[model samples]
Target: MTNPVKGPTGRVPGWVKVVGSVVLLLAVLFAGLRLSVLPGLKDLFGTETRDRSGPALLESIQDISRYEAASGNFQVVVDLEKDAKFLPDAVRGSRTLYVGAGTVDAYVDLGALDGDDVRVDDDRTSATLRLPHARLGTPALDPERSYAVSKQRGLLDRLGDLFSDNPHSEQAVQKLAVRHIGDAAKESGLTGRAESNTTEMLENLLRSLGFKEVRVTYGD
Candidate 1:
């Protein structure tokens, strides 16, 4: 989604044509991206998204890693794909099923579950989910132990690389989003298509996992 063209667009100035073309290409890419996810991404368009089903437990949802939604609060957004309340589900907070995306420094929160043999890299950038001779239980989650499964293949994670032409593949989407939107990547910037679409993807990921209150700030 990083369509970093040199300038702006139009019959007005020197950079307009270049910028305009980039904008258009980005737009097309974004449109195609939107189409790819279509109904799937609807829950996370401008705001957030949520899916409310039965007391569906994480119930052996193995591999819940890679995309970590940073420590934050929740907001509610209706699903663009469905007539149901999307983002709010996360806030409701009962039995839950969440999908999130983040840096995933690859650490396991032993404090959260049954885990042991804690280890860290020299850079403290990655960690693993281990169990102290205990196994996983379904419907009946044992607060004492279980592996923090982390896998990369969420809808957004998959969609992020759709047609990105990105060197880092789809995963680059997150880095790109965070980098571009950093501190100043808020408020004014939501004009370009690819970038905007990327924004959509990020928002969708958060909402799916229940981070409904995602404040998006885009950049040119």
Candidate 2:
């Protein structure tokens, strides 16, 4: 009463059955292996994420689309991030703006935050700016005089960056450092806000010194 499904012989043919079972088992093992390994392939369908801190290749920048301007002031739109974009098809391509483009010696008077980041009345070429003031509080830095905020670390970072063939590597490092330390840092003595303003001032000063089409915002 051996099953006829076993093959032409009354008893299952050893070779045929073994071959059939082995094929079936191999198929199953392959399927199981594929199932076990499949989820990892899900991420592969997508490409790796990219960061464009500075200008991109193949693409060009023109007409830096005027992202933000403080209404009628000095027409200021500062992009704190390096990837600020522009019209892609212009004759002149994308150029990046960076820090160290100005003197870190920008002097903040211990006056008041008159909300005067920049002020322009009308038909005036030379505008006035009342940048944020600092008291340095009880351990006060003198109001009439100037004080250095001491971004010397930033300077050293830039120096290292200069020697490196790729400046973006430093920026990448900065981005990482910002991610790790940024939270506690904001609440710490040096608010990232202050650092940001400093950067903005540096850019604006350079803009006045004649860097065209500047912007200041968080990286979009």
Candidate 3:
């Protein structure tokens, strides 16, 4: 061999340079995997979600005959707890916090109208209408916007969930939410607003039909 080829002082050895290059390449690969630059590798470790639900079935359809005059949007937080009679919270109790959103419609039932509900003068220049009071419809919850905020369960409750088909039942909370929304709608003057709107609508309609005067009244 020719003289052994000594390099300059402080220069790295060929083997050390080779090792550093290998380490740098490995670091780049790891970074690429973390950043999802390689689709094949990313799919290997990624989670796939699937919707296994069936198609929606057609239910009975009924014709609506009520005028939707006003709607109230409501939100409520429900805190519900259940406990065993003789067990401590840690042993057999559960608590949940849910946020519910819904809407309540106030409507006037034009379907309930009768001959006596409307009156016209001989010349048809004046008219009178007696209509039923506005009523509130059922509270409709917005499932897309409502969700459980937090839940805490005891050891036994947690264990029972492992074998239960419906681990976390929300029926009670949902019912409570509907009830609360209904109550709020009752106190929100929504029916009054509906009545006012219906009166205005009838007045405008009758006026356009050649009636110069219109009197609207709400009763049974």
Q: Each model's C-alpha lDDT?
A: 0.37, 0.40, 0.92
Alpha-carbon RMSD, each predicted model: 27.8, 22.5, 12.4
Arranged by TM-score, best first = 3, 2, 1
In model 3, state the lDDT of residue 77.
98
As for candidate 3, its clashing pairs are none
The most accurate candidate by lDDT is 3
On TM-score, the stronger of 2 and 3 is 3
Instruction: Report the lDDT of model 1 for residue 176.
Output: 34
What are the per-residue Cα lDDT tens digits for candidate 2 across 1-220? 6575675456677887789999999999997677668997645554687896987577665542111211110111112332224523232222232221111111334233344455544544444444443212111112223222222233444566678787554343233333333333323444334435655765687568655544432310
The model with the greater TM-score, 1 or 3, is: 3
Error of 3 at 95 (Å): 0.8
What is the clash count of model 1?
Answer: 21
lDDT of 1 by residue, 89-112 (tens): 223212211221222111112233
| Pairs in steric clash, model 2 | 61-94, 77-215, 77-216, 78-215, 78-216, 78-217, 79-215, 79-216, 79-217, 80-217
Q: Give the range where candidate 3 is weakest over 10 consecutive residues by summed lDDT.
A: 1-10
lDDT at 24 for candidate 1? 99
